[model samples]
Target chain A: MSVILPGDDLGISTDQIETSIGPGIYKVPGIKDTKLIPINGGLLNIQRNKQGTRQAAHLESNSRRYIPQVSDMVIGTIVGVYAEYYKVLLQNFLSNVTLSVMAFPNATKKNRPNLRQGQCVYARVSSYIPDLETELECFDLSTGKDGGFGLLDESGYIFDVELNYARELLFNPGFLVLEKLSTKCMFEIAIGINGKIWLKCGDGVPIPGKSTDEDSDKMDVDYVKDLKTTLAAANYIKQCQKVSPEQFDKVLAASFKGL
Target chain B: MSSLEVHAGVLGNSDGSCLYVVNGNKVITSVVGPIEAKARQELPQTVSLEVVVRPVTGLSNSREKLLEEKIRNLLQNIIIGFKYPRQTIQVVVQFLIADGRPEYTALELNMAINSAFYALVDAGVAMYKSFVSTVVAVPPEQGSSLIFDPSMEQIVASKSHHVVTYSVEHDECKIILLESNGLFEMKELKNILDAAKIQCLTVHEDVQRDVIESKLQQDYIWKS
Candidate 1:
């Protein structure tokens, strides 16, 4: 993979036997009738498979804001609750979604879940009618179960990561942060496709020999300490793709004591 | 000419920003957009592009407005406006420390254009192609030589000055924006354009190299 700028030419028709275009790429009509000039700024990827060679370009420098699509699992805060719909502010989207009262699990006319202002919920985008409004459902489509989707009650650390990074954290089975952290301590995490990550760990239990238990406000202090450590670990894992393995452990240990 | 020093993402609050410094002239640019637009300034089919040029001292005058218009038009052609309809993309260029000479206005404009381009790229604005521009001054006498990237003193002594912008595509250079002052024959103007095109390539390459290098540094830090 090579980094490309706005005007860099990927390849002409001559060298490229087949052409497969991806996002962040534009084709400019060239003087030669058979050739089309492909140019864009971002990361250039050339893949060779049984079919043929495919070239793609993607903007890899910064995380782009996420746009909601159908079936996207999003973590949003309840902004307002109406008679029929709940205004949910999504993580990265400018426009909010309307989560119907009936969308909640086991909800009836008079037995709907009590959702208050500024409450966070994990919901799935059921319908995304462009230019109108997005609709959300709290139940999973496959099992018709809650699937851990609902109001989050526990206090934890929330990090706003890049959209791509969030996706990687959610889908990638070999994600280093989860693998390393799970080995050290037990934790739970909810990854939003729109870049919001919620992480909760032990209930205010201080690590042995790490801190003094004499502080009366040990719980709050421990939570803060755990939040900071989790953030640092997440950041390090996000940057792991660029760091060498030998240097990774050293840097991670330096940033996090008792890694 | 002194070495050009360019720094991207300088302004913390802006969506995209850059600081360009060359020959004692420093221009800081910030871009904010694809955001909500004002009723009067909103465009139905395309994004509303605004360019604001701030001088070193006092308020922006008509001269600055003229420069702003030039940049706005140039950006409209380069940026994919239709992608962000009914929104606004505001570009603000501030002269932190001007060279303090009247004749260097062309140079200032060149720097402003370059800085704006980098800021837009940083902001992740979809551009058709980035442009590079340069200023050259030619003497009053018919046979006098043309000066590339003329200083304040050279510009004051010269009779004609030209600021030309070139965008490269498929290894071919095409002029995208041209602003010239003073009188010159058709052949003389063509000569200046040719010279400016060559100079623009060097500047473009320098910028391209710096941008890639910086991106690599960021990738190294954030992605393994």
Candidate 2:
């Protein structure tokens, strides 16, 4: 059997295959359907398989496109609620992830979890809610063996960031700005991409775990105050990280957010 | 709407894995196995889901922790925690880029979950189904345009925007998660969701292509 070599060029040249396959020699013919796969190696084996080998060398470069599939596990935050579903943020406008009642077998029309704005949760890919406007069903828990829940009513710093700044900060990483307060330590944070960083550190506090806060009001002023310095340090570090190492050294001297 | 590219098994030795990108924003996710539970750990009838979100640049403030919890919740729901008791599946998502658009990065993270699903399969873990995530953003201005997946620039340029992450499982579109500013309305909400679904399909197409292409490549090389 002759092997057709794949090539980057539009057409495979006949002269490209300088070798041949025969009864004795190890050389294998590299042409198929008159097309050829480029021979980058020496001594090609031309053994034929029962099922014909599919010519797939013409595959295009890989695309990094993000798609939501049924039964896929995903992470998202509570953005809002529509009539029958919660409008969730999948990551960016590149995609929207929805969790509708239809997807949740156990979810009752009345007892379904109240998905609030700013809340976070995880669900499964139940199905694609079809329409001119399509969506992903995220409630069928039968595909996997585990069930997970998301965070609720947790407060953090929000920052307004420049695109370049956000990218730099993401690649480098730093902290959120914290402000000391008599009642509540405030965090003025700017998240990159529409960057705005606003936070409140309570009186000398350790960061709370995910389960600590069911309501934002539960956050005490003392906790905010305590976290002020840490948030400030973290924010400073993040901002500084966006700058080059050398640039950070120079900018730190004049940086005003820390103050 | 923006496009996302997601790759699974981008890293090594992780139980579940993925590399996801929304346009230019990048997020990599890796899941470690359902190993033996800690001696003191009590969940013997189920597996534990630990999610760590590595921000692009800054320390994960309360919000990031909250994000982790959000991820944990969804994963816990899907991972059949009790199936493998006293075990842990560690999901590590590293945000390579943010582009100022949280939704963009978030969408990448969602895609990473799908990739992670494959990685989990690659690691020999069984699951009920696979899922995908999409984001919808809407500007606050009364008459401003509704963006499906706005870049950081667009989100910031607008007064406010909403991001919603949804998925489909068992032939139904389920609301998996959501995050947004406090101020938003119904009209804008519907528009964002509508647009986002289109974006989701686009991403799904790409993912399918990539997976097929990868298998082809592997077969070509392994056979050689």
Candidate 3:
């Protein structure tokens, strides 16, 4: 049955929630699992029952945006690094959750836990700060006798990316092909949606060909300059939209300065 | 591949401008005016929609040319070009990240178009239609039982991929453009299209919401 929100909304309408829907009635994604009983005004409300608090029944409405909640397992990557904390990207939300080094039970100054950009972690949503629209904490906390917060099982690496970078990876086929081509090496490159790339290796060796030192700085500069020139022409073509096939050389030359 | 943040207000004082990513790759875009067209390119009583894609670091090359043609065709189908005579609307989409998902580049193309259109609306340009676009995928492992708005991981893990594009105005079953390397029955195609159509409707609604909110924020909407 097609359950319609007011104004024929596919899900919960922002207007209806703000003005019309009462407290007893709610729209949730998995509410039916509880088998809620019908109450006054056609509202389906669930009451506490004998079987250890019957599961809450939910009917996901299209308009409802899911907010990350504590204990909710989510997949996120480290987007930013702090002295002893890390910022994580949880999809659909604007803010990143923080994981402090001290939160881990075995974390120490020498084994000083830190978040690396683009490192994906399976974390538990710890807390939310409504005023700041930020998530206060996330942890690798689990009851399986696993070592506390420092670093959990090192299954894989994660990438931190900006929104634009994520969008590009999501859409561009060439990037996937390039990664496939580069996969022979030990490192796994994680591209974050927020614009961060993280390289992780089981051997603990940093990816080859990239220097984390002064010399690498020069390489990056060269790369950015080349990128800028190529970008300028691409921008030009995009603006014109319909350049003749013959004009291709001219645009490419004008944009890619080195060529 | 890495993510990068980019933005463009308007380069060349065009109708609109955008900054986008190309699979961890980077690119920028700008739209030019609805200007008087050249004699050969002119339509006696219709406006024209043009598309161009630029690579971030190399020559125009064959691949870029192919993309420009393909994007132009897709745009033409959506745009109500006849609304404005003797006018030209140019779209520039640059490649920032060139990753493994070639078929997915069209997803970026569509996003840039939406951004450009948003700019055009802000610039007071008129249009007979508002195009709605989406990337619909059918995964390799899931067979045809599940359709998804694919993420990079899902797309990469899958053995084969199919990306479909749709325009809301041309609301017909066969109107989609499917880009895929895998095989599927016509029934699967129909199912994917149905899923995509729903997504297109959602996007259309979202765009309308954004437009309305922007107007409200600017106090452009009359209050009761």
Which model scores highest in TM-score? 1
Model 2, B122-183: lDDT tens digits are: 33343433345654555556676666656767656665555454454323445566666545
- TM-score ranking, best first: 1, 2, 3
Clashes (N, CA, C under 3 Å) per candidate = 7, 155, 58
Q: True contacts preserved, each candidate?
A: 0.21, 0.00, 0.00
- DockQ (C-alpha based) per candidate is 0.40, 0.01, 0.01
- Chain A TM-score across all models, in listed order: 0.68, 0.36, 0.39
Model 2 spans with C-alpha error above 4 angstroms = A1-259, B1-3, B100-118, B121-124, B140-145, B205-209, B212-224
State the RMSD for candidate 1.
5.3
Question: Chain B alone, model 2: TM-score?
Answer: 0.78
Task: In model 1, state the lDDT of residue B223.
Answer: 41
Question: What's the distance in Å from true for residue B15, model 2?
Answer: 3.0
DockQ of 1: 0.40
Interface CA RMSD, all predictions: 3.8, 19.1, 22.4
lDDT of 1 by residue, B150-194 (tens): 777777778889889998764578899888888777988898998
Error of 3 at B170 (Å): 12
